[model samples]
Target: MIQKETTGMILRKLRGDRTQEEIAAILGITKSSWAMYERDERVPRDEVKIRIANFFGKTVQELFYTPIEHYKCS
Candidate 1:
């Protein structure tokens, strides 16, 4: 079974060697805010979620965790 990665893990992996500061700057948020995101201590707003998803060629639904039952959205 494929275990879904946490938002933090997905964010960090997507970041690769890039610094959180640079990514945060690109997203127009503070460095610490970005760190909080990766630590799962905070949830970014939709705008930030969309920006990150676009940057990684993914949808916002794919970026954040979703309950299995929620997948029925058309």
Candidate 2:
């Protein structure tokens, strides 16, 4: 399994203010799939990860490795 940093960012992005279903729709995935991502039970494919990075206006490397303290959505 990957480290929790990625999952943590995702949670920060989705918690309270956003619904899993809404995020899933934005990512072109099913709610259940989004749930898997949230639970850190699965990692998105490379293409999906790229899409997610694009959605957040981040580079894939930044999304995966940048510290949350340094995160910039755009």
Candidate 3:
């Protein structure tokens, strides 16, 4: 089975060794705002979503909607 990966998890993986402040500045947003997005406490506006996806060289769908495989236990 599979489940959708949380945006926070995906963002963390994409962020790698970069700091939140760095990425946020590159995206022209506040560090705390980016932190909320990565924490899944808030969703970016559509325009911000586009910027984030572009920065990562990913489509918004790919970045925010990729599914993760998981095993179900009986």
Q: Indicate which candidate wins on lDDT.
A: 3
- Which 10 residues in a row give candidate 1 its minimum summed lDDT? 65-74
Per-model clash counts, in order, read: 0, 0, 0
Q: Give me the candidate number with maximum TM-score.
A: 1
Between candidates 2 and 3, the TM-score winner: 3
Instruction: Write down the lDDT that model 3 would get.
Output: 0.91
Candidate 3 lDDT over residue span 1-74, tens digit each: 55667898899999999999999999999999999998999999999999999999999998777655678999
Error of 2 at 38 (Å): 1.5
lDDT against the true structure, per candidate, is 0.90, 0.72, 0.91
Estimate the TM-score for candidate 1: 0.82
Per-residue lDDT for 1-74 in model 2, tens only? 45656664665573458888887898898988768777777777889888877877878787655554465798
Instruction: List model 1 lDDT by residue over 10-33, tens digit each.
Output: 899999999999999988999999
> Model 1 off-target regions past 4 Å?
1-3, 67-74
Task: Looking at model 3, report the run of 10 residues with the lowest lDDT sum.
Answer: 62-71
Show the colliding residue pairs in model 2: none
Q: Which residue pairs of candidate 3 clash? A: none
Q: Residue 59: error of model 3 in Å?
A: 0.4
